[model samples]
Target: MDHNDLSARELAARIRRGELRASTVIRDTLDRIARVNPQINAIVQDCGADAMAEAEALDRRIADGQQVGVLAGVPVTTKVVSDQKGYATTNGTRLFQDVIAPQDNPFLRHMRQKDAIVVGRTNTPAFSYRWFTTNAMHGETKNPHNPALTAGGSSGGAAAAAATGLGHIAHGTDIAGSIRYPAYACGIHGLRPTSGRVPQFNHSGPDRGIGPQIMAVSGPLARRVDDLRLGLEAMAGYAPDDPWTAPVPLIGPTFRRRVALVKRPGGIDTDPRILDDLDRAAALFRAAGWEVEEPTELPDLREAVQLQIDLWLSDGHEAKLAQAEQEGDAGAIALLRHYADRAAAIDVARFGEIFARRSALIRAWRGFLEDYPVVLMPVSGELPFQQDEDLRGGDVLTRLWEVQLPQIAIPLLALPGLSVASGVVDGIPSGVQLVAPPWREDICLEAGELLERGFGFPALLPR
Candidate 1:
């Protein structure tokens, strides 16, 4: 059997049933990475020796009649931006390549406790500041389906690695669209759980600013909806280190399976293919006994997206821009400068007011979500951008941001957003976004499963 083709949950079930050895799965995973990683540069740091040892130890424990965790024997990759004891949490920057983490982030520790083997560390853009993944430190991650298209930044390496079978699951952190966009671009599944649903803490780095503290979250990217569900189950929990971690149940109460389909939130001009994919996804949900609503009233997505960027840049935009300049990442520099230039006029009082008004926006969104448990929207206005499309010019960046309204807006509302790969359009992968109210990831996953079944999950690999 091709072990590499099996989902993480399936592989773990096989390992637990004694049909496959953990070591064998790990070795196969390592071999797959060795063969494919060079082409995509998804995994920036390989952990073959440690992974092999852990797998062999797991095998011994199983033979001794010990009970392993749910993710037993599954190989996974963690984004380099997170703390993973013994590896440098470089955040894809040359300035901190030597900043070795003294301890694992709470989420990584949780994954380890669940017996998920860390096979490698995936790459990210420098400081993880852009929508395109490239840096002077770890280089760029390419789309598995097409090299000319972006892999989707920040978590691009994780999405690419999962898409190509280098890992059964890839750990990713999202503040904006870091996790979801990559999944859409790479033809995989990524979940940006509601803030605080998954515990997170990076001891190796400085404390995060207010924006990230409230919006950023760590979740999983995988090839199947079932794997995403399993991964979230394993990662969800409270950590003493992360004050933001909420003690919420992974499973929430059942909701009426009604969906609100917003083809273009905020009147942004979306590519025809993106709208087609959304229509196709809505049809699938409707056929599967779901009540689909169109022309639904949604909150101001443009305001939310702009507020998110303002919050993200409010604390220290100039400092970040200067750092990006020093790092020599043209993309990051341009993005920061663009934001700084646009936000230059906002005084401190206005910034405070904008942050204070976030609660009102959340309240409005929650009320809308009360009637429709799931909201299906375009993951991006356009399909995956050509590699480095953000660097082309200011007009391109504006267009990119406009289409990414859904992605940026969800984080501000602290809602769970799921990116499900519907199918391939033309030569590129296309998909839709599923969002639910806070702590209601179950709703998104349930709807995602129906879409997966109706549209069928496509196994994407780089040519």
Candidate 2:
């Protein structure tokens, strides 16, 4: 049987029914990773030996008539940015390669509690600061669809691993477009759950600044929409470590299937292919009995994007900027310098003002989403760019940021966004981004499932 082709949902069901053993799945997953990871460079740290031991224990528990959790024995990979007990939370830098985590982060603990076996740790850019996944410590992560194109950062490794079947699900974090863009580039499904939906805290690292505490979130990336849903089910819960985490239910009240299709939110220039994909996805929703409309009445996304940047660097990102320089990753250096240039101009008063205005922006988006339960926009205004395109110059970085307004804007509002790969265009993956009101990940996932069934996008495995 092709174990690599099975979704986490399917794999877990089969395991529970005794048609497959936990050890079999672990071995198959590790073997597949060994065969493919060399070219992709996705799984930077393989935990196969420990994973096999855990899987064997799970099998023994099953044989002893013990009831396991929903994700029983499913192979998973956690991004290197997160704390996984005993592994280095490298965050893709040579400086911290030996910074071993004393305990698992809340999300990792949750996954293990549900019986998900962590097979490996994926890579990321230094400090997870770049949109393209490459760093001095872990090297570059290549897109499974096209090696020349970016795998997408900072969760590029997670997306690449999931797309190539290294694991059934990959854990990812997003403060900007990290999770969404990687999934779009690698041709998979990734969900950036509403802030506080999933508990997150890194005991090994310093406490996050206000921007990340509110905007950054942990989510799941997978090939199947149902698998994303299952992942959220296991991941969403309160943790004492994260004060921001709220006790919200995993599923929200159902709303009318009304979607607002924004061809170009904030009037940014979108590539022709992305617009075509949006139209195609809108048609699918219309055919699926959804009320779809192209509405010009939308929130000021550009303002939100700028504010998010300011807040991210408001705490005088000099320390991180210094660290980026020390790490000597060209991409990270460029990104930090770009933001530092802007940060230098802003004073404490202006930073305070920007933080204060975040509430109003959230209100504006909430009101807009009330009329339209879902908003379908570009995951990126353009398709995946050549790897390290941002390292070209400041002008290229500016253009890249403009094209990524769809991704950067959502984080400021602390809302949930899902990237669903529609199809391949011009030898690269293309997809649409879905946003809903806070705690409305269920709506995004449901809409994604509809688009998934209509498009029937084929999975892109490594050649």
Candidate 3:
């Protein structure tokens, strides 16, 4: 089998059983990235020498009869926003090009300790502020399936890289739709583990504001459901740096396969094709001895979604506006300008009120989840958009908002959601989002596996 296409679990098992060497796997992955990265612009900075040295060390350890972690010898990619020792943490911004880190962020360090080989850093928009990955720094990352459509942003490079077999898995962070949207666009699986289920911190800079502190989370994207589990287990290791990092097991003993499916939650205009895909997945699950309940609506979704927007942009409003002015990137400027009209007018008292309401919304969602272990919904309202499309335009933003329904609501309640690729419509990937109560990533994983099996896994593009 091609090493690049092997799931993370498969790669680790082969290495552990002496069927493959760490060096061979890492080298093959590096070669794969070199072959395809020029077209997709997925991997930004290569760490060839360091990755090879790490693989060599792992080979010696195995020879010495040492026990390695679950991800041992698996090649992985990290988002540019995450800190990796000896590399500059660009976060896809020119303002911080020289901001090199002396230590690894907790998530990267945990993955490294699991013996996962780091091949390179993936691209992101400047400050990871956009949903489509493009900026003045790393340039634009194209979708692997269709270069004319978006790869999905923030973690766009991660998704494209994983989709094209550049790496076994790629680390991704989600504030809004970063991880899930990219996974949907790339025809892969990505998890947004419950807030702080994975430890995350960038010691090189001051702590981020409340909006990001509450919503931004680091997780994984991979080509296979099994690989998603492997990536999450390694990334979820506990650390004290992030106060929100819950020290909990992401997976637990098996449970019933019952799920809740919502077609148009909160009156969002879901595309007809996507609704058909959701119904098809429900039928597949029903045949697999799982009960699928069609729910008309979810509690507090509209209010929670509004709260998410308010909380997310709370602190960065002015700074981003000024930066947008300086960069003169039309897309960034337009987005910031639109938000500025409202954000700049809010008083500190009103901001506090939003938080108070946020608490209430979280409570309501928690109550709702008690009866539904897994809620199935659309990943995006419609199909992927054209390349370089400006999402900030009035109608465009409305569509973007509707398509990102789940992304908009989950953060307010601090829940975990995963995007499992279902099928493709017109060559564009379509996916279903699985959401669960806070700290119940196991539910997401279980449903994701069922979906992956029901619809046979999609093949990667040939190198």
lDDT of 2 by residue, 57-108 (tens): 9999898889998999899999999999899999999999998999999988
Off by over 4 Å in 1: 460-463
Instruction: Report the C-alpha lDDT of model 1 over 154-205, residue by residue, as the tens digit.
Output: 8999999999988888999899999999999998889999999999988998
Clashes of 1: 0
Per-candidate RMSD vs. true structure?
1.2, 1.1, 1.5
Candidate 2: count of backbone clashes, pairs at least 3 residues apart or interchain: 0
* Per-residue alpha-carbon lDDT of candidate 3 for residues 395-440, written as tens digits (9 for 90 to 100): 7765676667777788778899999998766778888899988888
Q: Which ranking of candidates, highest lDDT first?
A: 2, 1, 3
In model 2, the Cα lDDT at residue 134 comes to: 87
Reference-based TM-score of each model? 0.98, 0.98, 0.97
Q: Count the backbone clashes (under 3 Å) in each candidate.
A: 0, 0, 1
- Cα displacement (angstroms), candidate 1, residue 77, comes to 0.4
